[model samples]
Target chain A: MNASITPITMPKFGLAMTEGKLAGWMVRPGATVRAGDDLADIETSKITNAYESPAAGVLRRQVAQEGEMLAVGALIGVLADADTSDADIDAFIAQFNAEFSAGAAEEADDTPPEPSVMDVKGRSLRVLDIGHGEGDPIVLIHGFGGDIGNWLFNHAALATGRRVIAFDLPGHGGSTKDVGPGSLEFFSSVVVDLLDTLGIDRAHLVAHSLGGAVALTTVKNAPSRVTSLALVAPAGLGPDINMEFIDGFITADRQKTLIPVLSYLVHDKGLIGRKMADDVLRYKRLDGAVDALRQVAAANFTDGRQTDNLRPVLETAPPTLIIWGKDDEILPSSHAANLPDAITVEILPDTGHMPQMERSEEVNTKIRAFLAH
Target chain B: MSKKSYRQAINEALRLEMRRDPRVIIMGEDVAGGQGGTSGVVDAWGGVLGVTKGLYTEFGPERVLDTPITEASYIGAAAGAAATGLRPVAELMFVDFVGCCLDQIMNQAAKFRYMFGGKARTPLVIRAMFGAGFNAAAQHSQALYPLFTHIPGLKVVIPSSPYEAKGLLIEAIRDDDPVIFLEHKVMYDDEEDVPDESYTIPFGEANLTREGDDVTIVAFGRMVKLANEAADKLERQGISCTVIDPRTTSPLDRDTILDCVADTGRLVIVDESSPRCNMAADVSALVAEEAFDALKAPIRRVIPPHTPVPFASVLEALYLPDAAKIEAAVKAVMNHKVTEAA
Candidate 1:
């Protein structure tokens, strides 16, 4: 392996991506590239995302041509120091290609972990359990109308040395669409049932948006079962929520309309790409999906005010860390204030309601550190 | 998401919907079989080919009801149930058996809303297995989607793959109007990556399985698979082709079909049904009427002859339009040219 030569491979933008097309190259051959700089435009089934350079070097060769589709981890380009000879660079490219082809073949044979449907008190729940280690485990609960896929960026990162489980709530994801009353209490009970089904006694509950409210209710209801709480712009923390986002999300059917609504979830509106909005629309179009979403909104956000006030959970709850995005239009970051001084709170700047996604690195680091303690 | 066979996909759709709403029920012959049997066992045969297997154990008998070998009474009963309250998914066993229950489907379920001046809604889905390949003979194999397509108030769906089956079946169950969901019996074992989540692909929307420039191939049900294979084979010969699966034949995606034909300047329709008055003829008439000026070559349809589906393996193989037939059809249309009036 050459230390100076760096391989810029096809990046996997999301969990579902198996292959991507090199739509175009942002940095041409002989161009100086730095880490985090856009190297190429890789298009996946869901969206076209800019492939960032993972190393700083001079772009020696664009091994994969524009518009050529390649499997994830396939060598798309090569980077090396400017002084590197052509023979050395050629050798590096050849070696990388040989290994990449073999790796691609093995990957083709290795299936990704599939989400399973469990009978949680007779309500079908879809859960993805990944990674394994010693610990109480990390239970991820997604927000309103969101599925386990919402944690696509953070779940693997946080599961380094612990069992991390992410599940679709009753009415979301692959779970049953029948949302009984769609209240926080109802959802919390389902979560409890899931934990019971998994035979997990105690686990750190990492929740996002409405899931935060559900986690709070769960702690208040059954404190012993939860090890810790990591709230991300939770519902019960405030009474005010952006009703427009909820309504738009539930009603918007087409890509053009849904894309703008998804923009509210992140500070960088560009993150609300075609594939992200398409995924939401596909979920919404499912039979009983919109109705379940409506029920959840009516029960949780009645008349633009959150019905649940779980602030008391924070006062006497387990070691809790509250994370909120300052640019969150759905739930104001100010709610992070006026909480018990005993509870540690971090308000992320330049991030919206979904800090776990926008600032996934920071959010994952914070969560791992909190869980460690 | 994971790879699921067409059988598993349909089963999941029915299971998910039944769990979601108590009003959604399954009724069909041997759907949850072994009722009143010597063995005293339940769920013996989950439908003839086990497409509805494991659902009975999950949902139980009340929702996953098994009916007698009576299509008329049971299909009629399904229509009545849908009108009253429950959204019933009645399995017709074989699409050829629709002849036994056409009055209930075409007259009762299909005409209820219009005849009653829009006061009634029949949220009924009649799933029937269609197409030939298993040597199931004439009665057991017949792509009769055109019958439902001709009806005024019916929505006909013929899913091409496992993924499409799940979504379209879910959509059919949730739809207010009567829907005829035809499953190709031979395709039950075909597998694809299907999301476990409940999703719906809207009716009348065509799925472009492959995009190309030289020709456009419109196919339905089992024919879509053959068309794709033919397109791939043709691509190697330097002649590219677009393969379109008009998922729902009745609410056919005419615009997509027409647009693709215009782009490619040639058309080849691959239909598994009999030649006369089939989807191929319907689509041909549509293109000729809407896109005559765009056509640079004559339209061609690759379909089974007017004779009944044969019983023997060799004859049956010839009876069904395979990839060779589709490729030849595409090549014929591609080679076609406008002649000067000599």
Candidate 2:
């Protein structure tokens, strides 16, 4: 019941995460803290990441031990003004625990978000639209072998102020696997049609890897629809690509084989965790995913090289920002060097092909700043 | 494009196929585990052996479906889905689990095209972990491809290594006919250089792993591994033997088998399945009928006795045919002299 006291809870890494283990605590009790500072290390099924302090205060108490597991949003530690009493902190902890447990129970009754499949132009596509209020919406298009959940870390973060939309491209996720010709144009048309179905006039398009090509194609085909473009380590602008990575990704079937292939996506091989690899394998197990990927692979990267070049289209488009991983192994970082000076380019160091995943915080910051302009 | 385990190869094939076709879906118990649990975790277990890991996250639940333990409904749904608009790769989990959903696979998926007067393409792939090893006991292990090979409408694929696994699986995914893709549990970790591109190995072409003029040895699935082992041991003893991997059982490369039989004038078939009505019996029948005049010795079959796979390691080892049994069979075939010194 202390007004100055606040609780530091176990943070949710992504939408799918419900619980996280306290891998380690970064700050000790009584230490001064600031919002956004690394407070603790939380390990989720997908990856281990540092939990940031939500508010600035003094670290009053460590309620959860380093090794204990807590539900997402459950109290892991306590923070308060230096003047707050120990008794008040204890009472606050007890009250917070009770409230947290009650809230979790209430949430247990709430239904999980159900992804809807829409018949967009005769092809089935899976879409997840989160958040509702005004402003032009932001649409997320994932790269090759990626689905809507690839934005699990970014979607909700960006949705706080406006509606954010993410969908599985045809042949990638829950979308109709039959991608006609499996070309960027085919995917770009689907994105525009999806916007039409949702009644959106103009929106900011954020795309990664192959999705980057789709977004660029969308801008070229229907310039009025795309308000802004955020391309991350995109494909169409590049000439050189690691066809070995693409081919390995499409062909690998088992864990021993896939683990090494997936390791190429991130600078930290550890980021290519068991769950991430398993997720890809599960997608590949789907009946039509293999054939769809093959068509896409052939259309996009024929004979181990990129087939499309959209630098000219992108050079003339509305405000654009190109983000590349300095250590991107899948698509070489050199591709980002050839961009027009008008196109703002940010090459993140110590990152890999999946800078959006490996260095999400920095990437998010760049994206936010670009969109603000 | 380097050495990969048999497990890695199969996983690669599934990964590639799923990436290629959006209509292609994967369904099985725990294939993408943690469905409807209190933890709110999805994709908990990729597969019993971790084969389906990483897919649920990449493709999401709708495409990489994690079905309930009830095999009949899902397997039948797979068949239904395939016939309608999807290419469903339903994992039966294990070959032994086939008992729970054989009707869907055999009666529905295997019969649709023919019953429909050749107007359908049931591009359904039923992937099941097969063979015995790891002391998994009776319920978890069984090499049941023989049951599928007997059916007329089904195409049976049994890949020997990682390279074969990727190519054959891609082929199965692309084929219009219903295919039963069997992965030997024991061979999953066995590595070989597998290509990264989407390429397929044509069915019915027997891969001659080793060639020799002394005797011809044909094997299936795990037996092929044993045959290679036996061939290697025999080579040291000055008795070289040819080892052939008949990758597909239904389209049993009878021509290849007969040609080898005629050239060597002696035959030995190593089949892990129980003796009666198996690939061994099938090959033996082909040689007996077609190459009756060229036979210099009676055909020898190294197979497990007609009994349930035992649980104990010692008993299981005895129950399963090994390189020793294969070597003995080859020697027996080679030792025969047509006229006893004529």
- Which candidate has the top score in lDDT? 1
Q: Give me the displacement of residue B250 in model 2, in angstroms.
A: 19
Model 2: per-residue Cα lDDT over B1-342, one tens digit each: 357777767777778788878887888888774554787876676577878777888888788887878999999998888889888888988889888888988888899999999998798899998887668888876789899999999999998878778878888888888899999888777886554545677788787777677899999988888899999889767687778899999788788788888888889998888789988999989999999998989999998888877889898999898999999989998888678664
Q: Which digits, one per residue and each the tens of the lDDT, describe model 1 over residues B45-67?
A: 77789888888888898888888
> Model 2, A169-288: lDDT tens per residue?
988777777888999998899999999989999999999999999999999999999999998899888778888788899998755578899888888676665566756765676656
Fraction of native Cα contacts kept in each candidate? 0.64, 0.00
Top TM-score model = 1
What lDDT, from 0 to 1, does candidate 2 have? 0.84
lDDT of 2 at A5: 80
Which ranges in model 2 have alpha carbons more than 4 Å from their true place? A28-32, A81-85, A365-369, B1-342
Q: In model 1 chain B, which range of ten residues has the least summed lDDT? A: B33-42
lDDT, model 2, position B118: 92
